[model samples]
Target: MYGLVDREALLAKVRAQMHDKRYRHTLGVAESARRLAERFGADPDKAELAGYLHDYCKCWPVEKMRDILVRHDMPRELLEGEKELWHAFAGAIVIQTELGVSDPEILQAVRYHTTGRPGMSLLEKVVCVADYIEPNRDFPGVEMIRALAEQDLDEALACALGGTIQHLIEKRKTVYPLTLLAYNDLVSRRDAQGGV
Candidate 1:
């Protein structure tokens, strides 16, 4: 199992690698993750760690990311999409191999932070929702989503997934199948009163 990284070192590395805007986003994600952790009864330290490193590969050159994906034998389906969305998976690998983040929960949080999966763990939901509704995020209706997160996590996730699906459709972008499945799963779970 991988051990936790030194907090200061990890933050410094993230700051040095990310652009100023991205650095701010990381800070926002960290704070949001911490809050969500507290609300959901998750480990704030792990949430913060996962949030800090979730985008570690965001700024990597496309070629480098592709190379890493190739080395890892990542599914061609996963590699077929836009480069913008590849960072989540790529970042997970980097966090595991480069940053020594071995915790499965933390790694999974980073992995699915972009394209959510069905039956998400609490930590995963926390990181995913936090990334979307962080203070630095200024998308339309973000405040409302943030409020929803505080009230009902499943509702917030449904909203976030719906918003993402709408955005993708409006942009004429390919919607990853996993995201749709995740959205449906969340809606179904909520309707069935299957609490997370």
Candidate 2:
């Protein structure tokens, strides 16, 4: 039953803690979230709030993130390997416990914004896709994904997941198994329905 936190206060805290680059990314995400919310018929305020706070815990030290997860008794399987990616779940906890946000939709949106999962809610998909295809994102082929986002969310998600998987492979980084599963799930769902 918690209500949305004060947006300005939340942004202030994030700005105080994050470096300029990270803060810019936050702003980009907020804009992207608002845009996607409009496109998908979601609440723009909630989308902006969720997107702005999606990375609240991203700036925390790795040890602090680990401690938060450990104290919450987060499943070890989810915590194992890819310690860098633990911030998303930890951020979910922070959003609920610290920010007084109780909405499952918003929490899930923040939780999966990084790695994403199957059967994501509309809000979740918006935040996830926004984070990936935000206008300020200048990675290779981002324009293509942005176009897909404008036209078809599912296709955009598929492309983003494929790109992420490929990038991880190229960097020799450990690809989270959930990411691959999410990609396949989206692809399968899209194909089964004749596209989304």
Candidate 3:
């Protein structure tokens, strides 16, 4: 079990950080993460906690996120890359310094939830996929990914990440390297297991 956590306090802090719409999304992700973790053998509490805190800095000014990334010496690629990805990296640090979250798994979950990396833990995958299939999310292909998640987490994530990559391509947006690597890792592992 995780350490004794102040759930109400944490929720209050998280709610104060985002707008109404995003707060609803965060709640959805927390519920979805809890469900996914129950099905996928992750710690449901950790997954839900990660869900609530994942977007802690999502509504912050890009300059503020970039400042934290710089002062914390986050990877140069992250600092230089898309601002959309900044919240995940910056949120992990803020939760620790500001919210007193010290668990490595929760921190990593928040860090990689936006742009997944290779060799992700089960909790990480749960939080990441939950972000996609949360009830508040209405993106195309989400239902298919949700169905896939019930059967296989890797395949579900592969489908979701592939969709993300293709969408980026269609919009002429740059796909982060770690996203590609995470997709490849899931696909390769599935192939090795004789799955498509």
Candidate 4:
């Protein structure tokens, strides 16, 4: 079923949704997602597609994203929390309704790419991590996350989530609950592994 998606058509649609910089970032994320998926034993194709679709609504007007969230009856927490998190959830619905994407895994990946949830799938982890470590991304700890990604996906993602939480704290911005849950889940899993 995944094989049937028109790659060029989808790419064109994704490209149309953002400015040149974001489109370039999307491309980088797609390639990076494919690489991460291969390294982590996930479906490379699904990872790439999710990467392309992940930010489909990122540059849209806040009002537009809010409208979609309201129509979809998204969680009140999400609706009230950071607007930065809206794009992922709204993109999931937009891709399905407008772009004909029906794969649950891919949709889930897009939905959680920004604010990762507890018990994320490998594909979701791939896209989320790819978004952070993509070539266009240049935050302070990105290189460390990229390095950790090469060795351990969970470690890399936990580090990335930690960085995000810290950044939000520094900015006095609200930290989304799911992101904290995701980070804690990774930490707990590592602890359960006897601190390995």
If scored against the real structure, what TM-score would every candidate get?
0.94, 0.93, 0.96, 0.96
- Superposed by TM-score, candidate 3 places the C-alpha of residue 102 at a distance from the truth, in angstroms, of 0.7
lDDT of candidate model 1 versus the reference: 0.88
Candidate 1 lands at a TM-score of: 0.94
Q: Considering summed lDDT, which 10 consecutive residues are worst modelled in model 1?
A: 1-10
lDDT (10s digit) by residue, model 3, range 59-131: 9999999999999999888877789999999999999998788999999999999899999999999999999
| lDDT, each prediction | 0.88, 0.86, 0.93, 0.93
- Model 3 weakest lDDT span, ten residues long: 1-10
lDDT of 1 at 29: 95
Model 2 Cα lDDT, one tens digit per residue, 65-153:
99999999987777786876788999999979987889888998888888878887788888889999877789998999999999888
Which runs of model 2 end up more than 4 angstroms from their true locations? 1-5
RMSD of each: 2.6, 2.4, 1.6, 1.5
lDDT of 4: 0.93
Question: Whose lDDT is higher: candidate 1's or candidate 4's?
Answer: 4
lDDT of 4 at 9: 74
